[model samples]
Target: MNSLKRIMVGLDLSEMDDTLIRYTAFLCSISEIESVYFIHAEKSLDIPQEVLESMPTGMPADEKLRTSLIEKVEHYFGPDSRTQVEVLVVEGSPLKELLNLSKVNHIDLVVVGRKFHMRGSGLLAQKILRNGRVSVLFVPENEEPKLDHIVVSVDFSDYSLMALERMLTSALTKPNVRITCLHAYQVPSGYITLGMNYEDFDKRMQGFAHNKFAQVLERFPSLDGRATLHLVKQENEDDMGELLVVEAKRLKADLLVIGAKGLSAAALFVLGSVTEKMLRYNDDIPMIVYRKENEEIGFLDALLGND
Candidate 1:
């Protein structure tokens, strides 16, 4: 949690934009976040020459518009505030500017609003999740920022384990917060062809799942009493993401935390399939997608051995 010192919040000036800002503010109030930046990326405004000529003599229309947007964002925070806030307006592609800003400022988290029904915002969110290196938290429209119930998806990979550790650390700071670590798995189709009884096969699979859960707990003894484990079985060997969404809904989880990628090297550029599907299928719960920081390798180590 100490790594999350600076936070960047994306603002589209839509009605839902305030929700993102308020939610980030709430997080700052609870966590050790030092500063928050509210940034708006202004895409093409397409103004004709005639309209420019009729504008005020001193300030241009675009400049005035940017100023107004900044003012509106500042107004949201008002005079009384516990955390330092800054507003910025940049002219370029939203995703591009946001990613650049995150890299330049070393942002720990990027907060943005997601509208399930809107195509433009949804695509923008997906792009951010795929391309941005910083951790992201997508808040749904009108959803309150609460940490009462949290669910972290685990698959025993380094990425998922990092995500679970981060979530557990954050939850430990809050009062009355409950955490559930969920693992969704499927049995291989070839097992059915081995002439095994269906009931016995199911029982064996369940036992295997329980054993793996125990191993996970043994690895992180800090989570022994602080978290609960939930195992989900998928008969089809697919739709792991869909099952996660269903479980989250059934548990009435307030937040869902997951890793940005999994154990595959193919996930270097884009998100893992399960993470992508969860983003597309669930529109009600807010999700936090975390990426573990890469460890720096020395020059000699890089040349002589795999680091």
Candidate 2:
């Protein structure tokens, strides 16, 4: 009901079947959401025209399923709620349909339910992260959402800046928000590392990282210097993924934001060791991953299927 005009939630029959609906309604009430959409996508093989004709609305049974989904969603949120509830059943690709709905409906935030392993499904999540325009909040099955401290994994890249901007925009209404801006840089070592003094390298890198963070802070002057700045230099090893989780847990951050492409499985393998390995398996902390515009997403090709 605040300024988050549209929130699109992806609902499916899974372990956390109702998690997205509950979370969406809760956020809608707090954000002053105008309308709430519960979209369910069904993957099907081929169907004869006769079957389609016999179905309600001359559509697939999936389309008829909208009625039940609507009832279930409303039951959770209750009929007394002010937010208008709309249920849609689209017969096609899941992510593609969701993205189109978001664009057409002017969705502000996209809520997705994330399940462990499931092979191909993880790829679907990756595709949504890569292709969708809305900010994606990946909620694990059965895990409650939290908003205590936000951990930002910053690489001082333009992509990271985009994620930071999202964080600032989403966090303003929060009365007390603790932000940890983390940067991990390599400190040259070994014989080549010995050629350059590690101390001086550490000093310059720390100053540079700190300065970049300061620039980001300036961008959001309203933050009023409440954020905690962190600069981490890797002398012995460089494991971005492991370090981020370790530090986040150490700081007890409730939310985490990181650029999507930066943490791609391929990028992690080539760029260096990354935190993605941990993220892929761990769902303890809810993560908001931002995929920038113009990024190619072959991984998400399945999500755009037949749409």
TM-score of each: 0.82, 0.77
Clashes of 1: 0
Please give the lDDT score for candidate 1. 0.73
Give the alpha carbon lDDT tens digit for every residue of 103-203 in model 1: 88888788888786543455676677665556888889887877678888887778888887776565223646777888786666667698887777777
Summarize candidate 2's per-residue lDDT along 1-307 as a digit string, tens digits.
1335666778774546576677666666545667778887767625555645534575447655665576668767887888887888787778777877887887777777777743236455555555565667777666665566788889978878877776676523465767888777776555254566767767777888878878877887755567768766654664567777677777777777776554344653432234345466446676776655445546534543433
Highest lDDT scorer: 1
lDDT of 2: 0.67
Evaluated at residue 243, the lDDT of candidate 1 is 89
Cα shift from native, residue 126, model 2 (Å): 1.9
Shift in Å, residue 292, candidate 2: 3.6
